[model samples]
Target: MNEADFAALRGAILALPYVRMLGFDIAREDGVLRGQLPFAERLIGNPLVPALHGGVVAALLHFTAAAQVMREARMARLPRVFTCTIEYLASPDLRDSYASASIVTRTRRFANVRVSAWQPHSGKTIAAATMQFLTGQMD
Candidate 1:
């Protein structure tokens, strides 16, 4: 994606209230769309285990997927989420976590994306999701 497109995407994401509350920092690096969720006290779901909230991980996956579709497909506007299915593989520690997304399929009006969230490595992914988005545009 070009600089301008990435900037627009960043702006759109930052505009979201929930995203802002979650402190999601998004960027493109080495041709990959990445989202980083900083560790915050409010994000701890299990105080006993001191693990990051599962919802937080799911939200990051969703956001990462949308950003990927918007940046890669160059959609004129933000795509509407049709469905998101997430699988939790492990509990995330109380630390910064990251997510990355890939477009599985793209047509005129819909896109299928696969997203993975991990703290340190892909092999230790905390969660994985497949999302379908309504692009609201024709190719």
Candidate 2:
């Protein structure tokens, strides 16, 4: 997706209370859909203590994958998560996290996507996920 498409999707997401509450802004672009996450001070973590919550990380991953599907399909709508799974590889440090996702495969009925989150300073993977999204009927 181009900047215009990203801007449109970003606007829709920003309008949501939950997304707004998370304080996420579009950080980078891969195409139409981009990645975002909470950058709040409370999102920071300690090496030996509670790190970024798994649920939060999962949310980012889920959003990333769903965003990709919505953008690539060019269906003029946001896709919802049918299901997703996140495997925590490492904890994110106290820095702005990074996230990205791409369409790995797609079929007439289903699309597969891969998403990842990381701590930029440490280059540690906070989470990785693969998800299946139902694009719904286009016609």
**TM-score of every prediction relative to native:** 0.92, 0.82
Stretches of candidate 1 exceeding 4 Å from the true structure: 121-123, 137-139
Q: Give the per-residue lDDT digits (tens) of candidate 2, residues 1-139.
A: 5678777766765666766776665655433345767467556444467576666677778766766676677645557666787889986655566678888888776788999988777867888998888887556
Candidate 1: which pairs clash? none
For model 1, give the 10-residue run with minimal summed lDDT.
70-79
lDDT for each candidate structure: 0.88, 0.71
Error of 1 at 23 (Å): 0.3
TM-score of 1: 0.92
Best by lDDT: 1
